[model samples]
Target: MALIKCSECGKEISDTVESCVHCGCPLGKVIFNTGNSWIGVFGKYIITDESGNVLAKLKENQQFEMNIVEDTTFYVQCNTSIRRNKVKVCVPAGEINKFLVKLGFLGIVTVVSKID
Candidate 1:
Protein backbone atom coordinates (compact mmCIF):
# COMPACT_ATOMS: atom_id res chain seq x y z
CA MET A 1 0.00 0.00 0.00
CA ALA A 2 1.03 3.57 -0.60
CA LEU A 3 1.66 6.01 2.18
CA ILE A 4 -0.15 9.34 2.28
CA LYS A 5 -0.37 12.26 4.63
CA CYS A 6 -3.42 12.55 6.79
CA SER A 7 -5.31 15.67 5.86
CA GLU A 8 -6.29 16.55 9.39
CA CYS A 9 -3.25 15.67 11.48
CA GLY A 10 -0.64 15.59 8.74
CA LYS A 11 0.68 12.21 9.78
CA GLU A 12 1.85 9.52 7.41
CA ILE A 13 -0.68 6.79 6.91
CA SER A 14 -1.53 3.94 4.63
CA ASP A 15 -3.81 4.98 1.80
CA THR A 16 -5.82 1.80 2.20
CA VAL A 17 -7.09 2.66 5.63
CA GLU A 18 -10.65 3.84 6.05
CA SER A 19 -9.70 6.48 8.62
CA CYS A 20 -6.68 8.24 9.87
CA VAL A 21 -5.52 6.42 12.98
CA HIS A 22 -3.81 9.51 14.26
CA CYS A 23 -6.71 11.98 14.30
CA GLY A 24 -9.77 9.92 13.27
CA CYS A 25 -10.37 11.97 10.18
CA PRO A 26 -11.96 9.75 7.57
CA LEU A 27 -10.92 9.43 3.97
CA GLY A 28 -14.04 10.87 2.42
CA LYS A 29 -14.03 14.10 0.46
CA VAL A 30 -16.26 17.12 0.95
CA ILE A 31 -16.50 20.32 -0.99
CA PHE A 32 -16.82 23.87 0.30
CA ASN A 33 -17.69 26.62 -2.10
CA THR A 34 -17.64 30.37 -1.67
CA GLY A 35 -19.52 32.01 -4.49
CA ASN A 36 -18.45 35.25 -6.04
CA SER A 37 -20.18 38.13 -4.40
CA TRP A 38 -19.64 41.74 -3.51
CA ILE A 39 -19.77 40.97 0.18
CA GLY A 40 -16.74 38.70 -0.02
CA VAL A 41 -14.58 41.09 -1.98
CA PHE A 42 -13.09 42.83 1.00
CA GLY A 43 -11.51 40.06 3.07
CA LYS A 44 -10.78 36.37 3.31
CA TYR A 45 -12.88 33.78 5.09
CA ILE A 46 -11.19 31.32 7.44
CA ILE A 47 -12.36 27.72 7.75
CA THR A 48 -11.39 25.74 10.81
CA ASP A 49 -12.05 22.41 12.40
CA GLU A 50 -13.96 21.78 15.62
CA SER A 51 -10.74 22.13 17.58
CA GLY A 52 -10.08 25.57 16.07
CA ASN A 53 -7.39 24.33 13.70
CA VAL A 54 -7.44 26.25 10.44
CA LEU A 55 -8.13 24.19 7.35
CA ALA A 56 -8.34 26.67 4.56
CA LYS A 57 -8.73 30.32 3.59
CA LEU A 58 -11.26 31.10 0.90
CA LYS A 59 -11.70 34.19 -1.15
CA GLU A 60 -14.61 35.19 -3.30
CA ASN A 61 -15.61 32.55 -5.83
CA GLN A 62 -13.28 29.93 -4.54
CA GLN A 63 -13.77 26.25 -3.79
CA PHE A 64 -11.95 23.87 -1.46
CA GLU A 65 -12.25 20.16 -0.98
CA MET A 66 -10.98 18.23 2.01
CA ASN A 67 -11.12 14.92 3.76
CA ILE A 68 -13.66 14.34 6.51
CA VAL A 69 -15.25 11.58 8.50
CA GLU A 70 -18.35 10.16 6.97
CA ASP A 71 -21.66 10.51 8.80
CA THR A 72 -20.12 12.77 11.39
CA THR A 73 -21.04 16.30 12.38
CA PHE A 74 -18.34 18.92 12.19
CA TYR A 75 -18.28 22.64 12.75
CA VAL A 76 -16.75 25.40 10.69
CA GLN A 77 -16.75 29.12 11.23
CA CYS A 78 -16.30 32.21 9.14
CA ASN A 79 -14.31 34.78 11.01
CA THR A 80 -13.73 38.45 10.47
CA SER A 81 -12.85 41.39 12.62
CA ILE A 82 -16.47 42.38 13.16
CA ARG A 83 -18.46 39.19 12.79
CA ARG A 84 -18.25 35.42 13.04
CA ASN A 85 -20.49 32.70 11.65
CA LYS A 86 -20.40 29.06 12.63
CA VAL A 87 -21.96 26.24 10.68
CA LYS A 88 -22.48 22.57 11.41
CA VAL A 89 -22.42 20.04 8.58
CA CYS A 90 -22.77 16.28 8.27
CA VAL A 91 -21.98 14.21 5.19
CA PRO A 92 -23.10 10.67 4.75
CA ALA A 93 -20.79 7.97 3.51
CA GLY A 94 -20.54 7.26 -0.24
CA GLU A 95 -22.33 10.50 -1.14
CA ILE A 96 -21.30 13.88 -2.29
CA ASN A 97 -21.44 16.72 0.20
CA LYS A 98 -21.18 20.27 -1.01
CA PHE A 99 -21.54 23.40 1.09
CA LEU A 100 -21.87 27.01 0.12
CA VAL A 101 -20.65 29.95 2.18
CA LYS A 102 -21.94 33.44 1.86
CA LEU A 103 -22.05 36.78 3.58
CA GLY A 104 -25.51 37.93 4.46
CA PHE A 105 -27.10 41.18 5.59
CA LEU A 106 -25.08 43.31 8.00
CA GLY A 107 -21.96 41.25 7.34
CA ILE A 108 -23.34 38.06 8.80
CA VAL A 109 -21.92 34.86 7.38
CA THR A 110 -24.08 31.95 6.32
CA VAL A 111 -23.37 28.39 5.23
CA VAL A 112 -25.86 26.05 3.60
CA SER A 113 -25.64 22.58 2.16
CA LYS A 114 -28.30 23.17 -0.45
CA ILE A 115 -28.53 25.98 -2.95
CA ASP A 116 -32.28 26.25 -2.72
Candidate 2:
Protein backbone atom coordinates (compact mmCIF):
# COMPACT_ATOMS: atom_id res chain seq x y z
CA MET A 1 0.00 0.00 0.00
CA ALA A 2 1.24 3.46 -0.87
CA LEU A 3 1.41 6.27 1.64
CA ILE A 4 -0.47 9.49 0.93
CA LYS A 5 -0.42 12.77 2.79
CA CYS A 6 -3.37 13.93 4.82
CA SER A 7 -4.99 16.98 3.37
CA GLU A 8 -5.57 18.62 6.74
CA CYS A 9 -2.42 17.99 8.78
CA GLY A 10 -0.08 17.18 5.93
CA LYS A 11 0.86 13.92 7.59
CA GLU A 12 1.76 10.75 5.76
CA ILE A 13 -0.67 7.83 6.04
CA SER A 14 -1.12 4.54 4.37
CA ASP A 15 -3.42 4.66 1.40
CA THR A 16 -4.98 1.37 2.50
CA VAL A 17 -5.69 2.87 5.91
CA GLU A 18 -8.94 4.63 6.65
CA SER A 19 -7.59 7.52 8.67
CA CYS A 20 -4.48 9.45 9.58
CA VAL A 21 -2.62 8.34 12.65
CA HIS A 22 -1.18 11.73 13.54
CA CYS A 23 -4.21 14.05 13.48
CA GLY A 24 -6.95 11.43 13.64
CA CYS A 25 -8.28 12.73 10.37
CA PRO A 26 -10.39 10.65 8.05
CA LEU A 27 -8.83 10.00 4.66
CA GLY A 28 -12.22 9.35 3.12
CA LYS A 29 -12.10 6.76 0.36
CA VAL A 30 -9.05 5.46 -1.36
CA ILE A 31 -8.62 3.52 -4.56
CA PHE A 32 -5.63 1.51 -5.63
CA ASN A 33 -5.00 0.81 -9.30
CA THR A 34 -5.14 -2.98 -9.08
CA GLY A 35 -5.53 -3.26 -12.78
CA ASN A 36 -4.30 -6.18 -14.85
CA SER A 37 -0.97 -4.42 -15.00
CA TRP A 38 0.62 -1.01 -14.70
CA ILE A 39 0.64 -0.93 -18.50
CA GLY A 40 -3.00 -1.59 -19.14
CA VAL A 41 -4.72 -0.88 -22.42
CA PHE A 42 -5.94 2.41 -21.02
CA GLY A 43 -2.66 3.62 -19.59
CA LYS A 44 1.08 3.64 -20.23
CA TYR A 45 3.96 3.98 -17.75
CA ILE A 46 6.33 6.86 -18.63
CA ILE A 47 9.61 6.50 -16.75
CA THR A 48 12.54 8.87 -16.67
CA ASP A 49 16.08 8.57 -15.39
CA GLU A 50 15.75 12.05 -13.94
CA SER A 51 13.75 10.57 -11.07
CA GLY A 52 13.92 6.97 -9.96
CA ASN A 53 10.17 6.77 -9.79
CA VAL A 54 7.01 6.88 -11.86
CA LEU A 55 6.60 10.20 -13.59
CA ALA A 56 2.99 9.94 -14.73
CA LYS A 57 0.37 7.77 -16.34
CA LEU A 58 -0.71 8.63 -19.86
CA LYS A 59 -4.35 8.59 -20.88
CA GLU A 60 -5.88 5.88 -22.95
CA ASN A 61 -5.68 6.33 -26.73
CA GLN A 62 -4.35 9.83 -26.25
CA GLN A 63 -2.49 11.06 -29.28
CA PHE A 64 0.05 13.79 -28.69
CA GLU A 65 3.56 14.10 -29.99
CA MET A 66 6.07 15.10 -27.34
CA ASN A 67 9.79 15.62 -27.67
CA ILE A 68 11.68 13.73 -25.00
CA VAL A 69 13.25 16.21 -22.63
CA GLU A 70 16.15 13.88 -21.87
CA ASP A 71 17.32 10.32 -22.14
CA THR A 72 14.49 8.12 -20.81
CA THR A 73 13.87 4.44 -20.27
CA PHE A 74 10.30 3.30 -20.64
CA TYR A 75 9.27 -0.06 -19.23
CA VAL A 76 6.42 -1.12 -21.48
CA GLN A 77 4.38 -4.19 -20.64
CA CYS A 78 4.18 -7.00 -23.15
CA ASN A 79 1.40 -8.78 -21.24
CA THR A 80 -1.07 -8.32 -18.41
CA SER A 81 -0.10 -9.60 -14.97
CA ILE A 82 0.10 -8.53 -11.36
CA ARG A 83 3.83 -9.14 -11.36
CA ARG A 84 4.11 -6.41 -14.03
CA ASN A 85 6.92 -7.93 -16.05
CA LYS A 86 8.25 -5.53 -18.64
CA VAL A 87 10.94 -4.89 -21.22
CA LYS A 88 13.33 -1.94 -20.86
CA VAL A 89 14.72 0.02 -23.78
CA CYS A 90 17.09 2.94 -23.46
CA VAL A 91 17.01 6.06 -25.57
CA PRO A 92 20.38 7.54 -26.47
CA ALA A 93 21.23 11.15 -27.02
CA GLY A 94 21.38 12.41 -30.63
CA GLU A 95 25.17 12.86 -30.35
CA ILE A 96 26.19 9.56 -31.94
CA ASN A 97 29.86 10.41 -32.60
CA LYS A 98 30.86 10.03 -28.94
CA PHE A 99 28.94 6.78 -28.62
CA LEU A 100 30.59 5.35 -31.73
CA VAL A 101 34.03 6.17 -30.40
CA LYS A 102 33.20 4.60 -27.05
CA LEU A 103 32.08 1.40 -28.79
CA GLY A 104 35.26 1.14 -30.93
CA PHE A 105 33.23 1.54 -34.14
CA LEU A 106 35.04 4.77 -35.06
CA GLY A 107 38.02 2.74 -36.31
CA ILE A 108 35.81 1.10 -38.92
CA VAL A 109 34.69 4.49 -40.19
CA THR A 110 38.29 5.74 -40.45
CA VAL A 111 39.34 2.59 -42.37
CA VAL A 112 36.43 2.92 -44.80
CA SER A 113 37.11 6.61 -45.28
CA LYS A 114 40.76 5.93 -46.14
CA ILE A 115 39.73 3.31 -48.76
CA ASP A 116 37.34 5.76 -50.34
Candidate 3:
Protein backbone atom coordinates (compact mmCIF):
# COMPACT_ATOMS: atom_id res chain seq x y z
CA MET A 1 0.00 0.00 0.00
CA ALA A 2 1.19 3.50 -0.76
CA LEU A 3 1.29 5.91 2.15
CA ILE A 4 0.32 9.55 1.75
CA LYS A 5 0.10 12.53 4.00
CA CYS A 6 -3.39 13.20 5.19
CA SER A 7 -4.44 16.64 4.14
CA GLU A 8 -6.47 17.13 7.29
CA CYS A 9 -3.99 15.92 9.88
CA GLY A 10 -0.66 15.83 8.06
CA LYS A 11 -0.13 12.27 9.16
CA GLU A 12 1.05 9.42 7.02
CA ILE A 13 -1.74 7.11 5.97
CA SER A 14 -2.58 4.57 3.32
CA ASP A 15 -4.06 6.33 0.33
CA THR A 16 -6.69 3.65 -0.09
CA VAL A 17 -8.59 4.58 3.03
CA GLU A 18 -11.88 6.38 2.61
CA SER A 19 -11.12 8.77 5.45
CA CYS A 20 -8.20 9.81 7.56
CA VAL A 21 -8.10 7.65 10.65
CA HIS A 22 -6.58 10.38 12.78
CA CYS A 23 -8.52 13.43 11.71
CA GLY A 24 -11.63 11.91 10.15
CA CYS A 25 -10.97 13.71 6.92
CA PRO A 26 -12.38 12.45 3.66
CA LEU A 27 -9.66 10.69 1.73
CA GLY A 28 -11.61 9.33 -1.14
CA LYS A 29 -10.27 9.22 -4.67
CA VAL A 30 -10.81 12.81 -5.59
CA ILE A 31 -8.68 15.84 -6.30
CA PHE A 32 -9.88 18.96 -4.54
CA ASN A 33 -10.20 22.16 -6.53
CA THR A 34 -12.06 25.46 -6.44
CA GLY A 35 -14.01 27.53 -8.91
CA ASN A 36 -15.69 30.96 -8.89
CA SER A 37 -17.67 33.00 -11.34
CA TRP A 38 -19.58 36.24 -11.57
CA ILE A 39 -23.08 35.38 -12.65
CA GLY A 40 -24.67 38.45 -14.12
CA VAL A 41 -23.06 40.95 -11.70
CA PHE A 42 -23.09 38.78 -8.58
CA GLY A 43 -20.69 36.02 -7.77
CA LYS A 44 -21.03 32.31 -7.16
CA TYR A 45 -18.32 30.01 -5.96
CA ILE A 46 -17.89 26.36 -5.18
CA ILE A 47 -15.13 24.06 -4.05
CA THR A 48 -15.37 20.72 -5.77
CA ASP A 49 -13.52 17.47 -5.87
CA GLU A 50 -12.48 15.44 -8.87
CA SER A 51 -15.67 13.43 -8.57
CA GLY A 52 -17.64 16.69 -8.93
CA ASN A 53 -18.82 16.83 -5.38
CA VAL A 54 -19.55 20.23 -3.96
CA LEU A 55 -17.72 20.47 -0.72
CA ALA A 56 -18.63 24.10 -0.17
CA LYS A 57 -20.82 26.69 -1.79
CA LEU A 58 -20.61 30.51 -1.54
CA LYS A 59 -22.44 33.54 -2.80
CA GLU A 60 -20.98 36.96 -3.31
CA ASN A 61 -22.56 38.61 -0.29
CA GLN A 62 -23.96 35.77 1.71
CA GLN A 63 -23.16 33.00 4.10
CA PHE A 64 -21.64 29.70 3.01
CA GLU A 65 -21.54 26.09 4.08
CA MET A 66 -18.81 23.47 4.10
CA ASN A 67 -18.61 19.69 4.11
CA ILE A 68 -21.78 18.06 2.99
CA VAL A 69 -20.42 14.55 3.10
CA GLU A 70 -19.02 14.73 6.61
CA ASP A 71 -20.92 14.29 9.83
CA THR A 72 -19.57 17.54 11.24
CA THR A 73 -20.65 20.48 9.14
CA PHE A 74 -19.44 24.06 9.44
CA TYR A 75 -21.50 27.05 8.49
CA VAL A 76 -19.71 30.31 7.94
CA GLN A 77 -20.98 33.81 7.28
CA CYS A 78 -19.06 36.13 5.01
CA ASN A 79 -19.20 39.61 3.60
CA THR A 80 -17.17 41.69 1.20
CA SER A 81 -16.62 45.36 1.78
CA ILE A 82 -16.24 47.36 -1.37
CA ARG A 83 -14.97 50.41 0.45
CA ARG A 84 -11.94 48.57 1.78
CA ASN A 85 -11.92 45.86 -0.85
CA LYS A 86 -11.70 43.16 1.73
CA VAL A 87 -13.58 39.98 2.46
CA LYS A 88 -14.37 38.87 5.98
CA VAL A 89 -15.39 35.40 7.13
CA CYS A 90 -16.94 34.80 10.50
CA VAL A 91 -17.84 31.72 12.47
CA PRO A 92 -19.36 31.20 15.89
CA ALA A 93 -16.53 29.00 17.02
CA GLY A 94 -13.43 30.65 18.37
CA GLU A 95 -11.04 28.07 16.91
CA ILE A 96 -10.54 28.02 13.15
CA ASN A 97 -6.97 27.13 12.37
CA LYS A 98 -7.53 23.39 12.44
CA PHE A 99 -10.70 23.66 10.45
CA LEU A 100 -8.92 25.69 7.82
CA VAL A 101 -6.18 23.14 7.62
CA LYS A 102 -8.69 20.37 7.17
CA LEU A 103 -10.11 21.97 4.07
CA GLY A 104 -6.75 21.73 2.36
CA PHE A 105 -6.52 25.10 0.62
CA LEU A 106 -9.81 24.97 -1.26
CA GLY A 107 -12.96 26.74 -0.15
CA ILE A 108 -15.24 29.72 -0.49
CA VAL A 109 -12.93 32.71 -0.40
CA THR A 110 -13.91 36.21 -1.31
CA VAL A 111 -11.11 38.27 -2.75
CA VAL A 112 -10.74 41.93 -3.63
CA SER A 113 -11.01 41.26 -7.34
CA LYS A 114 -10.20 38.79 -10.02
CA ILE A 115 -7.49 40.99 -11.53
CA ASP A 116 -5.90 41.78 -8.22
Show how many residue pairs clash in every candidate, following the order shown: 0, 0, 0
Give the clash count for model 3: 0
TM agreement with the true structure for every prediction: 0.62, 0.29, 0.26
Which ranking of candidates, highest lDDT first? 1, 3, 2
Report the number of backbone clashes for model 1: 0
Judging by lDDT against the true structure, name the best candidate: 1
Which residue ranges in model 3 land beyond 4 Å of their true spot? 30-116
The parts of candidate 2 lying over 4 Å away from their true place are: 1-51, 63-71, 77-80, 95-116
Tell how far residue 94 is off in model 1, in angstroms. Answer: 2.1
Estimate the TM-score for candidate 1. 0.62
Error of 2 at 24 (Å): 58
Q: After superposition, how far is residue 17 of candidate 1 from its true place, in Å?
A: 12
Ranking by TM-score: 1, 2, 3
Per-residue lDDT tens digits of candidate 2, residues 1-116?
67666666887777655556788665543111212222335434333233446544433333212222134453433222334444353543221111000001321111000010
Worst 10 residues of 2 by lDDT: 107-116
List the global CA lDDT of all models.
Answer: 0.66, 0.35, 0.37
